[model samples]
Target: MNRPAALAVLLLLAVSAGCTDTGPERTTLMVIPAGSLLYPLEDIEAAFESQHPDIDVRIEGHGSIQAIRQVTDLRREVDVVAVADASLIPDMMYRPMPEGDGNYTDWYIAFAENEVVIAYTGKSIGADEITQDNWYRILSRPDVRVGFSNPMLDACGYRALMVTALAEEYCEEPGLFEAIIGGSFDPPLQVDRTDGVAEITLPELMRPAGDKVAIRDGSIYLLSLLDAGGIDYAFEYRSVAEDHGLLWIDLPPEINLGFAEHADDYQKVHVTLGFRRFQSIGSERIGLPIVYAMTIPADAPHPDEARMFVDFVLECFQDGWPKSGTATVADKQIFR
Candidate 1:
C-alpha cells in the first residue's frame, strides 16, 4: 500500500506539472522584415503557430534599412531578419556570418522576388493620362503628387531613382530625372545643364521636381495614404501593390529592375546613403530579379524555434517568389 501511494503521488505530480500554466515555456520567435512583407508574414505566422501550438511569434515591420538596424544598431534580439534587398544581408551582415571570426551574417537564403511599379489609386491626378507610354508626362504635372521611400532608408527609394534614371534611357528625354524627381521641391525650379548632364541639389529626401513625389520609410508605408486618398500615386514594388490591392502601372522590366539581364544597366545609377549606424551604406544599386534574403541571428533567444520559423519562410519563398505559385529556392536567388 505504501509503494502504491508513492507511485500515485509521483504520477499526480507529473500530471500537475504538465497542466501548470506558467505561461508557455515553448520558445518564441522574433522576425524583422521589410514593410512590404507584412501580408506574407501574417500568413506564415498563423501557419507556424498552428503547426507548433507551443511557439509564440512576434513580427516587426520596417524598411529594409530599419530592419538591418534592429540588429546592427539597435542591438535588438531579432531571431530572423528578412529584407527585400537580398544583397543587404550580404553587404551588411556578411562580416558577421563566419561567427567566431568576423562574419556578421552568413548563408542567407534568397527566397523571394518582386518588381517595381507605380502604385496608385484611380483618384490620382490625370489618372486617364497615366498610361505606360506617358506616365512621366502625368507625373510632371504640378498638381500630381508622387512619392517614394527615402533612398537612405528603403530599397524602394533607391529603386525609384533607378527607375527614374532608366526612364530617361527608355524615353530619351535628357531632363526627365531632373524634372520628375529633382524638380519636386517645395520651391520648384529649372535645372542648369553642365557638361551634357544636368546637376541639381535636392533635399536629402530627394523631393520630386513638382509636389508630385511623396517619400516614406518603406513603399508599403504609403498604403494607408493611397487607401485614404491622401496622396495620389507612389513608387512601389509590384508585390506591395498587389498585396495591398492598389491600382498600379507596371513599369517595363528594363526600367523596373526586375530582370537579371539588365543588371549592368541598372548598376549605372548607384546611390550611397547614410542610414542607420553605418558610417555610410555605399552599395551600387543593381537591377536583378528582386529577391528577399533572410537569416537567423546568432543571439536569437529561441534559436531552434527561429530555425523552425525560417523553414516556414523558405517554404513560402519556394512558392510565393516571382509572385508565382511555385519556384525552387535556388531559382529565386539572384547571386547564390
Candidate 2:
C-alpha cells in the first residue's frame, strides 16, 4: 500500500478507537427513597430520563427511616429523598447536625396519600376464608405466618402496630395488639394508658419470634415472601398491594389511617421509637393520613437537577397521581 494511503488507514483506526473508548458522560441525580415508593419511582425515573437524557437518575430504596438516615445520619450524598411519611423530614432531617454539618433538609413537599391494608396471595393460609373480621384471628393462628417491616427502620412497621392497636378498639376486641405482636419482638410492644391517653413503646431491635412474624427491613421485601407462600399475610400500604396486584382487604378509615376526617381518632394512638438515630431524639410518631413527601437535601451534590426532578414528580402526582395508585395530597400540602 502507498505511504499516504497507509497513513489515512492508521488515522481512521485511531479515530474509531477514540469513539468507542468511552460513552457520552451524563450528570447523575441520586434519589434515596422509601421501599414502598420503589415501583412508582421506577416508572417516574423512566419518564424523567427519557425527557432529560443528559441527566441520569439513580434510585436507592430503603425503609422510610433508613432512607432519610442515609442522608442525615450516614451523611451519604443524595440529590433527592422521598419517604413514605411526610412527617419524617421534619422529625428527623430538619434539625441542625450534631457535628455542625448544618441541617439535612429544611423543607419537604407532601405529594401523595396511602392507606394500610392486609396483603395476601391465593396460596396464603386461609386465603379462601379470611375476612376483615377473621383476619386478626387468622394471623394469630399458629399455622399462619405474619410479616411486617421493622418499625425502627420503616414507617409501615409502626403503622402496622398502630393498626392492630386501633383494631382492638374498632373491633371491640381487647388485647388484640398483644395477641398478634405482644411476644413476637425482642422488646415487644408495650401499651399503657396515662392521663387518659394511650402510649405505645417500641423496642430498639425488632427480632421476631421464630417464623410466626417475619420482620424485614422494608415493607416491599415481604411481597416476595407472600408470593412464595412463605408468609400468610403482610401489613402494607394499599398502593403497594394494588401496585403488585396482590389480593388485599381494605380496613375501615378509622384504623386504616387513610382519611383526614378520622385524623383526630388516629392521633389518639402514638408510637415511640426505642432507638435514637440522627435528630429524631425519640419523638413520638402520631397517626394521621398516610402522606408521602419528598425533598432535595440542603447538601445535595446535584441541587439543580434534584429540584427539577422533584418539581417533575410533584407535577406528575398533581396531574392525577400518575403510575402510583396513591392519591394526590391537597395543593396546600405541597411546600415547593
Top TM-score hit:
2
lDDT of 2 at 34: 82
Residue-level lDDT of model 1, residues 1-336, one tens digit each, is 122333344344334435333445766678898988887677667656656667778889988867887877677888999898787877777555333644545668777777788888877777777788888877766677778887766778777877887787678887787567766665643333444332233344444443466677666568777777767888888877876777888777677877666666665555444333354355445544576788876666778888778876665555454354222336534442
Assess every candidate by TM-score: 0.79, 0.82
Candidate 2 lDDT tens digits, 192-280: 75764567887766777778888887766798888777898999888788778889877888889887678888888888877665464
Relative to the true structure, candidate 1 reaches a TM of 0.79
* Candidate 1 lDDT for residue 224: 75
Task: Provide the lDDT at 77 for model 1.
Answer: 82
lDDT of 1 at 135: 88
Clashes of each: 21, 0
Clashing pairs in 2: none
Model 1 sits at a Cα RMSD from the real structure of 10.5
